[model samples]
Target: MEGGLLFQFCNWSTLLVCMVIKVPQIFALLSAKSSRGVSLKSLLLELAGFLVFLRYQSYYSYPLLTYLEYPILIAQDVILLLCVFHYNGSMNQAIPYIAVFLGGWYLLALQKWIIDLAMNLCTFISAASKFAQLQYLWEARDSGAVSALTWSLSAYTCATRVITTLMTTQDLMVLVRFLIMLALNIWVTATILRYRKTATKDE
Candidate 1:
């Protein structure tokens, strides 16, 4: 009974946090009228990772609670992507990206092996997304419009997922993904805070 309640708490809490996880970043962009510190590649890769993980869970009939937050995360990512494109004055360039993502979504379930392969690769893809963001921050040396709150909340969600995954599905792949994501999210959050501090000191 205790474990069940803890699982529910973690799952619901993760969902609740995910619902607004990207808001700060989106608001930051709109308020500043720039996407200076955001990485388009990171967003795209992260979207791809989410799509794969969500589809994998649904395809295998995993518990709904385990992956429920993914749709919300994906939606926010789409909105965030549009914001980034709009600010970068490259909205037209978004067409190809949209097309590819749609195509990949369909292809994910074409064969069981394909998704298995994708899931195995998902960690690297998601990790690449974090690295892309880290690279952006390193190059820019400025947080710019990036939201530290967004990344911190992301880390929180990931940490909760780690607990929920162990309590529920216990799928090694899923567990591994959450673990990697939790670490990367923390790393990104730290990087964002560091840059923000440096920028403040310079001012």
Candidate 2:
């Protein structure tokens, strides 16, 4: 029992640290004048993954642990979807992909025994989305309009995810996955600093 308590404590500690650091992302868009050069690819992918997450909720019977962030996710995802569309300079090509993503989820879920498969797909999707965003942030030279809060949140969120992945001992690939996310978080955190430096210089 003591061991369980210790595990729980460790999880909470990691969660708190990540959440506090992630708060900035929640406010970044609000504080920024615009989202000048942020890409939509990750957002699109996240939305796609979110659909799978939604399916996971249903598969898990919407357990107590799941709905913990339902409202937060709904609000955040709505805002992100809008932001993606707004930032996506190429609506013509983007829409088709987005549509296909949505359509594929419904099609995939049709198999009754595939609930776990669906959930796994969602995890893969969200993971891919975050990594893609991290890459984009790394490549971006000017974050003039992007919110610091958002990137900070991304870093912290990835941090928490790393902890969770480690704790769960999810699978053989979990180590690789955690390392990849850690690298992305570190890279983006560096990007945030570099961009902030240049942005400050302009002012």
Candidate 3:
């Protein structure tokens, strides 16, 4: 009983931590007043990734406290997307794109097998999305709009998640997903710091 309670405590704490970590990124975007350093594609792809994960949650036999956190994660991405739109001065034009993407993803959630496939696809997209963004950051030689604190917190959160996941479940697929996220977060954090000089010069 003690172990179970501890596990539950860790689970809830981690979920709350994840939510709080994302807040820094949102604030970073808002403060930057430009999405120049941040990758809009990455934000969108991650939103899709979270939706796929959310669908998978419905099919997961065991109930998880973190499952409830998916919508909050998605909402963070949406806010970032809106920030992107705001920075681009194209909020109205971007609305339909967001709507259509959500509609298509929602349809895929209807079937289990499709959701399974989509989860993998979106995970890949989410991983690749960070790489794509890194490429943009490299070429642009600017990380002005990207927050080092955001990536720092994200990397730390991903690491915490890996530990929590291991304690609770032995699901291979889930482990792989978190591992990928951790790797990407580390890469982004490193890339941001490496380019700090150039990004500052550019600004």
Candidate 4:
């Protein structure tokens, strides 16, 4: 097998691993019935990030793994959305947000000129939105609302990302995106641990 094909295979394998691992998160939301701690804005931001990633991926090789990721994310987000509304008993209120975000992502994913200076701004905003979600989890005393399995999958993917960064050099955007993901995973993990310690002390 050539290097590109081999890398694709690895990417697909990792993607499969992510989906299977993320199932626990979906189950946690469903079984616990508590999306109260998760931030709606964070899901919106993630949906936006994946929309950007999908457009950027189109300009590059797009391993099979790329195809798997966004759909799984979409599914989990849907589950989380339902859980959030269910817990709040505000299903009607959540509907507009969902429709707007879904429609926005669909529209954004259609672009051809993949890179713009605005992408950096959008990506940073998305990252900051995850911080909002983190704060909610801490304030509400609910790690159950967050995705534990996604964390484990991220830990695994961190190494894979380093390799991926080395794999292809055509699309600077793709490389940059993976590196951003790598950095976000590191920061998110550290923040979670730090918050856990503080919460532990308060208790």
By lDDT, the best candidate is 1
Stretches of model 3 off by over 4 angstroms after superposition = 1-6, 198-203
| Model 1 ranges with Cα > 4 A deviation | none
Provide TM-scores for the models: 0.98, 0.63, 0.86, 0.74
Ranking by TM-score: 1, 3, 4, 2
- Model 1 RMSD in Å is 0.7
Tens-place lDDT digits, model 3, residues 91-179: 99777877877797678867778877887786697798788788888888877778777777766666666666677666666678878
Stretches of candidate 2 above 4 Å error? 10-23, 53-71, 84-105, 112-131, 138-140, 161-169, 172-179
Give the Cα lDDT of each candidate. 0.92, 0.56, 0.75, 0.63
lDDT of 2 at 39: 51
Model 1's alpha-carbon lDDT is 0.92
Residue range 99-153, candidate 1, lDDT tens digits: 9999999999999999999999999999999999999999999989989899999
Better of 2 and 3 by TM-score: 3
- Pick the TM-score winner: 1
For candidate 4, the per-residue lDDT at 51 reads 62
